[model samples]
Target: MSTVPRYIREYVDVNVDFDKDGRMLPKTLIWEDGHRYEIDRIKAIQPAPALKAGGQGDRYTIVIKGHERYLFFEHNADYGDEKIGKWFVERKVAP
Candidate 1:
């Protein structure tokens, strides 16, 4: 049996800040269970596809609690804020 973990797109509520030049800077994210995680720093931002899941967006390389993770901003999803779009993380799910 293949032991590779399955990934699912898990949408989360994110707090963001915009610069004067309209650049987005993500501050923190709240999970479905109300757990919050602060983004320590952004390593890089680039347009990439979620290979684990199934989507495409600007992937943000962020560090949280000394661990790095990819945070995706799928610009097409209308999650109450059309101007900002929705944020998601490729979460590992059990098969």
Candidate 2:
């Protein structure tokens, strides 16, 4: 039997760039350890579904160091009564 790699969701700091259309594009990933990884290439982008109540989000699939990684950003309305944004990176573990 073969094993599938599992991705662990972790919040990370990211620098994003927006085009003339105001679309968010990831540029670099800043690790808490102070190591920075340039995005290099973007494989896919998926917009998060909007909730009937409010808050919306976006997800980007990126390639870094020849590995597939996911960068996610979301806005939550009720966390602090004020809208707040969250950023995260989903990293995969080899099996």
Candidate 3:
């Protein structure tokens, strides 16, 4: 019998913002195909060591540009698992 490798879920960073109280807010994450999804549910968040010296540590956000849209993500403070916030491109896509 042949075994198939399990596909791992991947996420990309978008943007990060601070509340008036300075608490990090939930981030967004878009699909590889530029589809938008909500991450209304979060589990936990923790600080992590820098992957490398002077690497700015692991608390940061990322932006990904897709053919049809742009995706945004950032470190979350509600989930132990890594996740990003996402939204659709400002412009509408053509059918």
Task: Tell me, by lDDT, which candidate is best.
Answer: 1
State the weakest 10-residue window (summed lDDT) of model 2.
48-57
lDDT per residue for candidate 1 within 46-81, as digits (tens), equals: 999999998999999999999999999989566676
> TM-scores across all candidates?
0.89, 0.65, 0.34
lDDT of each: 0.92, 0.73, 0.38
Clashes of 2: 0
> Positional deviation of 75 in candidate 1, in angstroms?
0.6
lDDT of 2 by residue, 1-95 (tens): 87875655556788888899987788999987978999989998887632322334677778998988667778675776563576776556665
Clashes of 3: 14
The candidates, ranked best first by TM-score, are 1, 2, 3
Clashes of each: 0, 0, 14
Q: In candidate 1, how many clashes are counted?
A: 0
Worst lDDT window (10 residues) for model 3? 49-58
Q: Estimate the overall C-alpha local distance difference test score of candidate 3.
A: 0.38
Residue 16's C-alpha lDDT in candidate 1?
A: 92
Off by over 4 Å in 1: 77-84
Clashing residue pairs in candidate 1 are none
